[model samples]
Target: MSTAISEAGNIPVNAATPVVTYSPVVFDVPGRAAPLEIKVSAPATGTDLPIILLSHGHGETNFIASLHGNAPMAGFYAAHGFVVVQPTHLDDKALGLRDSGHPEAPMFWRSRVTDMHFILDHLDEIEATVPGLAGRLDRDRIAAVGHSLGGHTTSMLLGSRVDDPEDPQTGDLSDPRIKVGVILASPGVSDEPTDGVMMQRVRMLRFINFDTMTTPALVVAGDKDLNENFSTRLSYRSDAYTHAPAPKTLLTMHGAEHIFGGITGFDTVETTDEDPERVATLRAMIWAYLRSALYPDDKAWPAAVEALESGAATSSGTVESK
Candidate 1:
């Protein structure tokens, strides 16, 4: 990875440390159609480290939609003192279920949310599975982070309920175990017009409600990411931060796109906006936010907010918290 100096003229914490990764850690979910598989990554050496459960975005790219994607963020988080866990959701194209008559086809949004809970339920198995990782985790400190459809999953875990369109009843998938969340380029409002196959397949998108998303979260949106297909207005993507209650933050990247500088993978074609500096800023700010949120007495989040307000970080983005 290329290194970029932060406002303090030093390498960011994410890039300064090294990490160890273990993949294909299998865990069984009783009654689920298939077993859940995950990839775990952590700092080479650290005790009492926090945990970050990352969910990958849904797309046609089979591998990327699984735990294999988001290496950039996973590695960064792992290197910077967090044990990152990524799961391969049922919606992944790699399973070749598109043509099959599966019940939860297309988005499988509900299953995605449950996948996270399953991971949490089996943390003991995860620790035992990973060599040299037992007793090194801080179980009480846990956070969920996601992108795109995965962000929707994370939101549900953070108390965003979905109203069952047919039943008029809401589903509460929120997990009290998840202390904080971070949403990257997730769909907002869901008021956009739809037609053709997308209208029929992704009907669950309309029921997403952020009014009850009271969890402390950091919502990151790209100013230039005009996802017209998802919403009529670009600002619609910022609904997570806009609709959620206090203790929420919005980080608007000045000139970023959906991928936010190749966060899905290193130097991949999906990254429309490739700015190393912007990615570096994200690394520093997210690390700071996670640290401060997990440890209330920590001042990293406040100091980073001050830096952003004072034009100390080259004005890469604007931060607003409430």
Candidate 2:
């Protein structure tokens, strides 16, 4: 009921800009093997709007990127007037090393990295499909968002600094146009590729033995998460506040689940916690960080957080998590 009411509304990517959705197009990013399912929608009015591309975690393992199915987050952002892209990584089902051959799939852990770069190369995705869409995406002001495995991608895009940003490295993170920071939730292991898990991404950020990072960042995870340690470390957690050479923020959800507050694709009411109050708090933190980093000078964000603490964020009728 609440989703019906709220989802019916529209988010202004620009001032009173009429938002529109183009017919869906399915394609894969170059260099990867799998064919990605992508659909873009944005404001029709000609104005420069920020672009936010999303990469879902291993769908079979975590159910992060299901399209036209039960659980999905790409639509949420696209509906908010963003040019959203969802890469269909069929190789994840095999559960082996990163699909180095997949077009959109990152080689090794840098799959998230390639996803961002490929989207930048094909900026006309929205325009080619949807008319009058060029002005909506200000390529210079772009951001990346990922969940679980995808969350790791978010870190690669926005963290302090990569050891050699210009080394012509080719893997999951060989992009050259990542400008803004990142938003990562329930991130997986990202320690230097020493004895860490084989699935872990090889992080280039300074904290991992490099010098320092130049990009701002934010990390969010549930204390009850399954991969809390990896998530925390990647997000820059320390006993004391260790400000990033670039700005950074880290958050932990006390009673939340391993999946960063259980924002499922079903009904919001069906989420692990029917208690929207707390769940909304987590969501507010993420959305606010995105707004501040991507859409600066937006005051309503803080107020939205306050309201979401017990209002819309938690308004979902789902029961509280155990």
Candidate 3:
């Protein structure tokens, strides 16, 4: 595949080679009361294809935070030869777990990580459920991609650990099976919680630690995403990239915001920046990053970085690596 980013920010999708999608693929979790539901999308043809476990961001909208959202990104990845699997976490508004008093209520951070792990463990069953998808997935090459709160989930799978103040010796939940990750608009490290209702709603953000985040990842953040409710500075959103070790990259979108140009859905009201070109740029960059990270010898990542630095891709973003 070429490393060039088209003006429209999309690689041509062959209409004849359509993508197939399956939703609500049920899998029973051993300790969970409800079976896990997922949406699977893949190219009509291809074998041993890489897998992308897409974790949806928690949003005010009921369905956007569930397996039903992010069709634009998922469809793009599927069309580009990746098997994308998105799970509806217990925290999804559609489940109405708020009044149920679910143990992982509120953030449901731990359960979110477990959801991704459960999906990886049941890939065989998931593939079998979809017609013509059997034995087509490259189990060995897997990556996790997430946005916002979902990005926090992706970080844990990639070796990031959260220290429990109450239990100092708590073990890390990092899953070794995930080879790489891409974190978009994820929460940053904070010494203390922000004042007011935002703190009560997202209390878990203050305890995140990036020292143990050893996996190779690409951190994408927006310059104008000054999420005042979460942090005092806009740069706070780039913490995942600034604090992580080498073999990590930071893609700072110049005029972007939390939604990153409507990636959550097509023409959704949540998008503060509605530039389709920006979304396309994000798609192209992510595709290049995943390709090169999965294969050391692949030049797509470096080439794409060069394009960004040289202003060939677009002047709206800048990239840095350590």
- Give the whole-model CA lDDT for all candidates, comma-separated: 0.82, 0.47, 0.82
**lDDT string, candidate 1, 174-260, tens digits:** 999999999988877666555223434577766678989988999999998876556667886688999888889999988989888
TM-score to native of every candidate shown? 0.92, 0.65, 0.92
Give a tens-digit lDDT track for model 3, residues 154-263: 99888776776765544588888899999999988875445334555665676778888999999999988987678777887788888887778999988899988888
Candidate 3's C-alpha runs over 4 A off are 1-17, 167-170, 192-197
For model 1 the local lDDT of residue 138 reads 98
Backbone atom clashes (below 3 Å) for every candidate: 0, 22, 0
Whose lDDT is higher: candidate 1's or candidate 2's? 1
Q: What lDDT does candidate 2 reach at residue 278?
A: 45
What candidate 1 gets wrong by more than 4 Å, as runs, is 1-15, 167-170, 192-200
lDDT per residue for candidate 2 within 211-303, as digits (tens), equals: 233465555555444433344343332211133343555555556653444454444332454333444354444445566667678764455
lDDT of 2: 0.47
What TM-score does structure 1 among the candidates reach? 0.92
Rank list by lDDT: 3, 1, 2
